[model samples]
Target: MTPEDLAPDVLTDAAAPIDPARVSDSLDHENTLKKDFVRRVRDCLEAGESDTVYDLVEPLHPADVADLFELLDADERPLLAKAISDLMGSEVFAELNDHVRELLVESLPAGTVADIAEQLDTDDAVAMLEDLDEHDQLAVLAEMEPEDRAAIETALSYPEESAGRLMSRDCVAVPEHMSVGDLIDFLREGHDLANEFWEVFIVDARHHPLGTCQLSWILRTPRHIALTDVMKRDQTLIPVLMDQEEVALRFQKYALISAAVIDEDGRLVGQITVDDVVHIIQEEAGEDVLLLSGAGEGDINEPIRESYLARVRWLIANLLTACLASFVIANFEGTIAKMVALATLMPIVAGIGGNAGTQTLAVTVRALATNQLTASNAWRAVRRELGIAVLNGATVAVVIGIAVSLIFGIPRLGAVIALAMLANIVIAGLAGVLVPLTLNRLKADPAISSSIFVTMTTDSMGFLVFLGLASISGLVG
Candidate 1:
């Protein structure tokens, strides 16, 4: 549904309305949900006034409530959940952060979690259950209805992050034999159909998707018109095993509001809507940025041990790469000692190169993720980066050259460092583009590996070039 569809202060009649200003402030800023509100809720919970806690939360949108849950401490969640058990619904669960949701689910009984699963769509239900331990998963599944359990089981069997795990089973599908009138009547009469859908799928006898009929078309067309006459035969179908990122790209490329997800046999099993893909896009964008920094998952709700393990391994890897720069500096130890200026000026070279490399790395990784860069245009991408580097290097060299001459009172020393600066910047740009491209070619995650190699390349080269230039130019002596 669109943003215009929702009421600002309240969701339903049963939900006690909250101040619109509270929602407005929360929506406008990164963390506008004030501590005072949280403290008030805590006080209510502490005093065993569950009704007060419920009264405060009942009016907010499910998304807002989800945000509120994030603002609360982990210990406060169960208390809040207990205070508003009836008010908590599928919408709130669907809007929850994955890590936070998992914690809450773990705290609840298998049956309670199963009941929440039942309230969500098949894909969301699978998402909520798939993270639990296998034993716990079985227990939760056993507590679910046979139909819901079966759907979740099948989705879990597909690889994680695949379209099968991302698509909702709650879609309306009709045989092409039906007319508009028949389709409309079925939709009005069917009790088990999805409550929220933008369009309906038209299928053939084999249950393979043949076309799609948007809700608008159904309303506009005459009742006697056959489904095929109104349906758009051209549709983007997602393979069940296709990665969710690719699925989201397809949705964007086609401007599709919804698409059918099919199994290997070409029978439609589920559907992916724009709303589901929006979450995937946001998650992937954020996940990649965090991975680039070696910050695992970057979720506050992640277990401490898991966060430690994720970061420590990358730190160990970084230590090894840092040694490469140390090795370069070690070879020039005598030169540096003889001319203290060489030691003083060298860090500037490495620091600038590292920053340049990072700039290029960010752009290249983003291009690759967006499908803007690939084998076909990789050479062009490299050439474009090189041109940018040359310009950037020339600009940086002039500024540093003048500064060094004024600071050190040596024009030749300035020239020597200037040349080194230009060379290192060029190398930085090359490393930034090449490293990620190489990782991508090797079937590794470019975002995860690119930064380390790029940083190492820039650092090692930065030291090597600057020291070598000073030694060769005899400016240090």
Candidate 2:
């Protein structure tokens, strides 16, 4: 069944038409549902008043309805879904958090899941199903109509998060020979056209996109004006295999509302709209931040086991690095015995170096993510970071050196600590920038393990430099 078939059934109780004033009352100035409003719904649900729960939720916008689902307890989610089954439309499903949606979907029947998927755009449908286990996915596809199933199956065949999977099959494409007037007439009469489109793609007989014309351009053109005459010859054609992040970058760089997705032979297969790219950009940005901290997804609703596995592995790696740092300190036990002040002052040097390294690491990762750092300018970026590092090192060293000398009255000890601080901070800076650049060059996501290595380098080198310097500077001897 088509999405249109499901639209008429959603929020159609005309006897109780939505009141804008009541909808506003449910939300606060921040746009989130008011606490008392949520509490009332929970009370009704607990009292087993399904009709009352439905009444409370019916006036909400689909996105607000989605937020309500997330705010409810996990068990209450299935109950809420049942109470407002009609209002659980495609838009609400599209707005639901991924983990919450997965849980709510699993409680639903396969037929119900298929119906919801059919109502969504191709990309949203794929996102809904991609997280399901293979058996459950097959079951849902089995219940779907042949045409919808075929489109989703084809999208699933592509790599996850690729343009082929993200692009919608519904788009306006016409033969290059058509006039603007002819295209307009055809669009008015077409029964199965896309629900929303920004531009008309003009294509050759083989369906290779020749150019594109905005809707406004067609409407203002004379009837006799050929489409090719008005269509801009240049276009950004996204390859089907291109990653979604790259696709988002292209859209942003070109300020595009929509772009054609082309297959291997350069034939237009589908189109990706700005709405889809907006979601991708948000997801990718969050994903990079979470990965940098080794907290996979960092989503509160993620399964406990999955979160544990993702975090424990990173913690274990950190533990190993900490051990390596400890090994450096172990080698200088006698140095610390000769001067106990060395023990007290060593941690200060390592801590400052770590903070400096983290600052550089965050900047480098962000630059690489946004494509600001590249092969042509990588050397320049390295030099820039090092310059900043040296300035930072000199400034921090002077302050700590003065403080140590004033408090302890040991000018020689202060001098040793100052030199060590400057050395370690410079080393931290080098490690921070070089580690990520090296990982990027090796085709690895620099955010994944760059923090771990940079931390290790700062910690180990800080201890070794400070203790080794103190032992040889005649302060300990």
Candidate 3:
């Protein structure tokens, strides 16, 4: 459609114009879009009132517009996009959830997708296209300008979740020889420079980064001073192949606003800003937790098939681990038959032990992710966790023992269970800390497999220890 086709028409009697001041009515106190507003949009879309839908959505922020798309039914998303096509700009697309954006992008023509891609930062653009199948990806790339195409193609060459794909190609880099006056003039004249940058990189003739000058420093420094004099000689330079999680860690560690990304030869290539790092931090944090639970991305928008596949494998693995736990219990069936209460109380020991293991696993995984628990302090972290586990075990065992003895009037049974609880909890703690550490040492994702192994250890051991004590202590008779 031509620009004229999208021009705002005068408000009709059928749909009155929305007052800007009343737009807050669309959102709740927490800034989430109200269900009533969503219902109104859905009603308009169904009624073929496209103009009213546009008016309702146009006043919302780009992020809100993206949220509205996600809130709508999948079938209705394209209709909303169609009605407010002019408002579906790069910012809205950038803010969109991956699955929702993919759905919209796939429905649009290749040229339209290309146009949206062109308007996005290189990182955001690559994110939008990387998930497309190769054929469709090539079609969109073929429609983009050569320079933009080259930038995206180069970014795609890097491994997924690497800094190369996350960094924006647009950054301000100037020769070190240039004076502050010359730099300012160049920035003023350089229409093609990056639209937003926190710092200006000073590079040598070969485009090797020498230092970085914050925009504030540049503005405050004397114009006649050499760029080198005002720039900080010590700066964190991100290697192109560094994992995006590591990049986020560096940003968090150094409190960086922006950092220059470098090639193998140490030449400046792209820059990663804090805004991009914010998204990386959130993604990695959520990914690790979901992976630990075997939940697979945990995004509600994720396709049913993909979510099912990701979760089923873990469930199957858990099933196998659970069989191992059952095997331990099978060996104690005679003892359980002798003492029927054993069946009632055994689950408490196993369940509490499993909870302890999970707590330790979470702390260890987070420490490993943040580089807090490395080889240097690995043993210290393990000992610290073990210490905490013992205290927790003792406290819980005392409470459960007193309650079981009073409730069942069997002091021997209570003593047996108390000892079993303590042993199982300590075992759980050891497994929790050691499993992830071993996985990390093997160059595997500690978060992915740690929970499976830890849960197996806790469940199997809890049953074995509790039942063995019951049998040997004569509590079963």
Q: For residues 1-477, what per-residue lDDT tens digits would candidate 1 score against the true structure? A: 221211122222254557887556435456445677778888998898988888777657887788888888887888887777776677888889888998877777776677778889998898888898899899999999999999999999999999999999999999999999999999999999997999999999999999999999999999999999889999899999999999988988889889999999999999999999999999899989998999999988788999999999999989999998999999999998988988888889999999999999999999999899999999999999999999999999999999999998999988988898999999999999999999999999899978999998999999999988888887756
Candidate 2: where are CA atoms >4 Å away? Answer: 1-17
Task: State the lDDT of candidate 3 residue by residue for 24-66, as single tens digits.
Answer: 9788999999999999999999998999998889778888889
- How many pairs in model 2 have backbone atoms within 3 A of each other, for residues 3 or more apart or on separate chains, i.e. clashes? 0
Which 10-residue span in candidate 1 carries the lowest summed lDDT? 2-11
- C-alpha TM-score for every candidate: 0.94, 0.96, 0.96
Ten contiguous residues minimizing lDDT sum, candidate 2: 1-10
* Higher-TM-score candidate of 1 and 2: 2
Alpha-carbon runs more than 4 Å astray in model 1: 1-32
The parts of candidate 3 lying over 4 Å away from their true place are 1-19
Cα lDDT, model 3, residue 209: 94
Q: In angstroms, how far off is 168's CA in candidate 3?
A: 0.2
What is candidate 3's CA lDDT for residue 377? 95
Error of 3 at 137 (Å): 0.6
Pairs with backbone N, CA or C atoms under 3 Å apart (clashes), candidate 2: none
Please report the TM-score between candidate 2 and the true structure.
Answer: 0.96
